[model samples]
Target chain A: MADVVKFDEHPSDTLRAGANFNLAGIDPASTPGYSGDKGAGESLLSELDGKLTQLQEQLFAESRTGGKKRVLLVLQAMDTAGKGGIVNHVMGQMNPQGVQFKAFKAPTPEEQSYDFLWRIEKEVPAAGMVGVFDRSHYEDVLIHRVHRWADAVELDRRYRAINEFEARQTAAGTKIIKVMLHISRDEQQQRLLARLEDPSKRWKYSGNDLKERAFWDDYMDAYQAAFERTSSEHAPWHVIPANKKWYARIAVQQLLLDALNGLALQWPVPEIDVDMERELVRRS
Target chain B: MADVVKFDEHPSDTLRAGANFNLAGIDPASTPGYSGDKGAGESLLSELDGKLTQLQEQLFAESRTGGKKRVLLVLQAMDTAGKGGIVNHVMGQMNPQGVQFKAFKAPTPEEQSYDFLWRIEKEVPAAGMVGVFDRSHYEDVLIHRVHRWADAVELDRRYRAINEFEARQTAAGTKIIKVMLHISRDEQQQRLLARLEDPSKRWKYSGNDLKERAFWDDYMDAYQAAFERTSSEHAPWHVIPANKKWYARIAVQQLLLDALNGLALQWPVPEIDVDMERELVRRS
Candidate 1:
């Protein structure tokens, strides 16, 4: 028999299984650094920026003619895993008028009383607008998993629910991009300790944070399980390794560009009468 | 006696004040267009960017050193003004690692019941971090002022309270910069009308926004009063012209650099021994 290539055995071939890259497995020496992909990433980013700007102008024009679409991005992660950093850098290139951001937190009585998605639903971007969430509904999985706020069966159900929820949003013309920032435990400790030492940062630290830190193993187990259950084809999680912040940021920018690349938009051309154009130029 | 250089009644002095170069009210004709100051702005921005990068690095170093300081910025503006654009563009220049952002909306019942600052306080940046607010507590003065949610006397009290509140935060090492993007009503209408035309942007348009638009004059009165009452030595408001978005963004960048200029921080000197230096050079 002819020799058969075992695709699953090779790391590169494993990528065909819908995992574009294994972020955690990358080694600094072997992997191309962020600046190394600077040419392609920068080109893509600049192009995407230009497209977005032109798209916004077109949307503005269309809104005058008829209405526009909204874009939503949800970022969820463990502590010190770079959610804030990713939002800052990835969206940095876009027009602010077309963007909005909200950071979700512990719910109040009102929010708790309503459906879990109610508070978040209010924050979804308006059409032609971009909305980013620092920590999103997946917190139900991460926090609820670790805190046992929901039972095992319930947690599993919630995971499936999130997928359906995101799919519905996508159907409603909201493009959903979800990212999972992955950081090692050592990095989180360094970050937490750093937060404690800085006077400006002292307010961010609490005695309870240390107590949570002690349960690191439990959180990791929960995260791994969540990953196994919730990652889906419609709204797959991009596990971004965040030890090298700059690289991680660039990776996120590239990921966003990749997702948005399919949305081809054309700028509305200002209707120009030939005579008026000549007269306008002559006047100038 | 030598001729008085500038008497209050002198027309030349008025002309000079109108011609003031550092962004005071320059005449429309002589007001260098947005592109006019691009060269200087870019050069200054590049230099400022370098300094900011260094400041952030030092801040991060101390973030781990023990007890760190944090910085926060609050932005409040009228509708059709350029708050979102400014946030997107100027904040883009910053180092993502140490920066965070939150956009405030109508408060929940819990937020309303507690002190107004509760929801906002939870969103403050931790030490070694920078936080930006899209619309902050000033909303109470601007929106509530026009809506009559607070009576005149209560509104008057809140204005004073805001200055004191921000001053307290400033003293606590939370460097505060407040900005108000000022756009002409005509320009605002132009933008708003455009939003209606574009399908992608249609979602941002609301019938109620037009109703609010009807109270433009009232909002302006409220804004003027708010500015007069709350502009403080510790936390002054920068009123930026938004007719020109590029100019507004550049001005904001300059303001940020000016606010941060006082923090003198240095990069950790390369850990060095004479023998190690010699060995490193020899190996190279």
Candidate 2:
């Protein structure tokens, strides 16, 4: 019943695709597909929660019966673009048992010794799971390009490697939902200041965060380059305007809903004889 | 404010410790500690959600600054006793980013090759995480003892190994909450029947479940033996009456809240110069 509640515009279509996409054209504060105000958005989200939970359970059940299909949500964003908020509000609504969440930090010495995707390959969600990457293999291209850690040839090679990697995942029954949470520099400053002002939030503030703010333009360019190279038909990037935290949360929730719905998931058939089991249970 | 709302008796005290514990003495249908009716209990649980979320966030924040304190909830129960429900309703309320959930099944050949504690040690909560085990190393004792897979000597060795492993974890600042969700045989039958009749829930039913039910008394004995030998000051086993799903959920939530509250967690001091960072953010 909740799935019948429709948006004026489907976020999946409006938000998807990165080819010839311009970062400046999108407004971070706008709610694109959702028509309602904050209260309605929140209400619809609560309604959608039940549907999402059921779909996820079906997926997990399917996995138990040798279903290989799973979902991987790849989140790439700058500092304070509300990636954690999305994880908390959207992905957090699902059963934690069915969700595999991994936050990738800078590579360690051992990780640096291997290809960038080696550590990532280790954390992929198994059959019937919804895997979430807080910051994923995209960083190898985004951050590396910003700092010129790799030459154009190597950067280009990394982009090809990423596309190939994602294609392989899609071929193996993984539906990859790649998202870029787009937030403005002004919004980042405001968020950072809020973190600095509140003692409870101060722990999140760091000197490096401010230092990173100085490279705002360079990071934007890096993101655009990465998008142009890696976004493909199998795994298109969805640029979510994340300045309004509520809007971003709802939009991402919609994207996940669509992904799960696209799977047309149904509960797996019971492997046992129901009549015999029922009789046995009754006698016992 | 929610924490100020008190139970008639603290579940932490009422349900804790297994010394001379009688599994049959506790009524599965009775609501222990909580004095409220179902409606009131559900309301109180909704209220407690905020408190639990804040406490978990503080634990996670502490970990960012080298705080080693963490909590591990180990849930063990019979089939259809609601281990998954507790995880969905209780642990599901917290941010998934801070919750580490692992469900143990029959060990694979690789897992069986290692010491029983080896697989468990790998899944322990890192600093500032709330780790949950759906079923854990206790299976080595419970299932093994019930089926006579191991003799008295090996079972005794395993109990000691589990105790020592938990002691080391506590020494390293992990607070372990071990819970056994106790349900009546009649309740399990009703639950299995409901699963058998509902097509949506049929995937959860297996013929093996009915087979396991025949050994109910043996499983009970094995559980009691596990509690006597393994429960300790650092890691105590709390047997929760789970016939009423609401009571079991809130009682477990209270146990987790008490564990986190006992830690006396505080937000870590900001490592950067606050005024300087604020001014820099303003400039940016």
lDDT of 2 by residue, A1-284 (tens): 12333478988989876567887789988888777777777778888889889999989999989999999999988898999998898888899999999999999999999999899999888999999999999888888888889889999889999999999999989999999999988899899989988888889887877777788888988888877887799899999998988788888888898999999898889667778778888999
TM-score on alpha carbons, each prediction? 0.58, 0.97
Residue pairs in candidate 2 whose N, alpha carbon or C atoms collide under 3 angstroms: none
Give the per-residue lDDT of model 1 (tens digit) for B1-284: 22212112211122211211232242222213233454554454445566565566566556544635666777776665777666656765665555677779889887899867677778877776777888988888888988899998988788877877887787777777777676766676666766656645544555555567778778877866776787676776666666776556666665665556655554333233434433332332
Q: Tell how far residue A95 is off in model 2, in angstroms.
A: 0.3
lDDT of 1: 0.61
Runs of candidate 1 with Cα error greater than 4 angstroms are: A1-41, A51-91, A94-254, A258-284, B1-57, B196-203, B267-284
Q: For candidate 1 chain A, which ten residues in a row score worst on lDDT?
A: A4-13
DockQ scores for all predicted structures: 0.10, 0.86
Scored against the true structure, residue A239 in model 1 reaches a CA lDDT of: 58
For model 2, give the RMSD to the true fold. Answer: 2.2
